[model samples]
Target: MQKLRGALIGCGFFAVNQMHAWNDVEGAVIVAICDRDPERLAAVGDQFGIARRYADAAQMFADGGFDFVDIATTVQSHRALVELAAAHKVPAICQKPFARTLSDAKAMVAACRTASIPLMVHENFRWQPPIQAVRKALDAGAIGEPFWGRFSFRSGFDVFSGQPYLAEGERFIIEDLGIHTLDIARYILGDVKSLTARTLRVNPKIKGEDVATILLDHEAGATSIVDVSYATKLGTEPFPETLVELDGTEGTIRLSQGYRLEINNAAGTTVTDVSPKLLSWASRPWHNIQESVFAIQQHWSERLRDGGETSTSGADNLKTFALVEAAYESAASGSPVEIGALL
Candidate 1:
């Protein structure tokens, strides 16, 4: 198989993990890198042994020599970069919180569709091992007919230390973090029909809400709650772990803290450790996320080569991104937002 050459457009904090993952990927490799910061571009290029580097994305795309472009920049730049990729006829994988707004996301999707380029939003939370385990159980009917579910991500960890920009955002947890939980909810239960949300800013220092609870009515007639917080202080601190509780007609599935997945039904009860593997370049608490970054990238490579639709294609992620928009709209108005109406 011919190797897929990928050019990455962000050389910042999280993009380091992406660089490492791309190295470990079987059929894809990063041949060029672009970032506005010359220092970051040099640093990541040296670390990854990538020789080609560009400070301007426009110049890099004009001189394109890669099969795809990975847009790992923040939300504000996502739409422009994706459109740029579409214009250049390069397949793209963009980092999430898909865009700054639903309208922008829709436009990006439309641009990609018109260009006939494969576009995937890097919503990697659902690719995490434990989360996949929960989905597998539901599909296998370990919990016969899931009727209600909860996806919780609570942590007191100081995420602001590594990414100081997080503290400066006008929209914080729900957009940056809850987006993942909401995507996980859709991935597990199904599509949402309506959603209601309430949000609060527990910490006075931050500009955005630190806590949020979302109630989702799935089109499949299932109800689920997606709650996320950066303010919750637990005994041991389950930072970055997404705990799940699912109730079904004949059984239940629990994805508890410490990556323990338990399923109980008429057949019996089984508990398993569904922890993510720590890759050589990955560290402790972040290993699960790092693993997922690799998994999603590999999936993109396979699908791109095989001409199949990505699991989180731009069209599919529009639904997940809509939930974020709906959450904010519902929270401000104190009413249930109809998903179809927004879509």
Candidate 2:
């Protein structure tokens, strides 16, 4: 089978991981790249051996020869870029924090639908090996109808060092990190019915909240908490790990900090190691996320080739993106925000 040709826009910090993953993906290869900064563009193009580089996205789209376009730009450019891809009838994979607002996400989805092009958000947290294992266990009835759960990611690691723009944003943790956790919560426990959130800005140096605790009422009557904090300092920093606790009618599931998965039922308790594979270009702590990037990109390639809908399709991601918007709304109002209303 001929590999699908892909074009990647925005050669930033996270985009490098996407580029590395593209190299690993079986069915796709990035043939072109675009970035506004000539120096960064040249750097990534040189690093990845992608000779086709453009300083403007529009020019790249005009001269496009690729099967799909990966929009790895930041949140602000998401809608415009996705719409541009849709205008060209190119299947697009957008980086997470899908859009600035739920409405913007909805419009992007509509644009793609009208163009008859596939649109996937790079919501890779659900693609992580451990997270997928938890979902698989739930599917196999290991937990027997989960009712209560918690998805927690707390760390003091300096994320701003690599992406200093993180500290400058007025909306921080929830948008940057918690978005993944929230998506995982939805992926495991099902869609949220309502959400109530409280946040704090612990680090004075940052403009946005570093700590956030959110309560979610799942549509299937399950209740879950998504708590994330960049201000947390632990002896053993979990960093990018998302610890999960799931309680069900028959048993429970726990994904601990050390990539340990424990499942307890009436029969017995079983402990297993559910660590993500360290790819050649992936590093510690971030390998889990890096692996998921490859997984999701591969999935996009397969789905685009097979004429099937992607798991994190724009329509589906609107629900997850809604949680982010609702979080801020709830944090400000000190009241529960209805997910249905936001959707």
What are the per-residue Cα lDDT tens digits for candidate 2 across 1-343? 9999999999999999999999999989999999999998999999999999999899999998999999999999999999999999999999988998888999999999999999999999999999999999999999798999999999999999999999999999999899999999999999999999999999999999999999999999999999999999999989899999999999999999999999999989999999999999999989999999999999998999899999999999999999999999999999999999877
TM-score of each: 0.99, 0.99
Candidate 2 residue runs with Cα over 4 Å from true position: none
Candidate 1 on 228-270: residue-level lDDT in tens?
A: 9999998998988999999999999999999999999988999
Please report how far candidate 2 places residue 314 from its true position, in Å.
0.4
lDDT (Cα) of model 2? 0.95
Query: lDDT at 189 for candidate 1?
Result: 92
Candidate 1 similarity to native, TM-score:
0.99
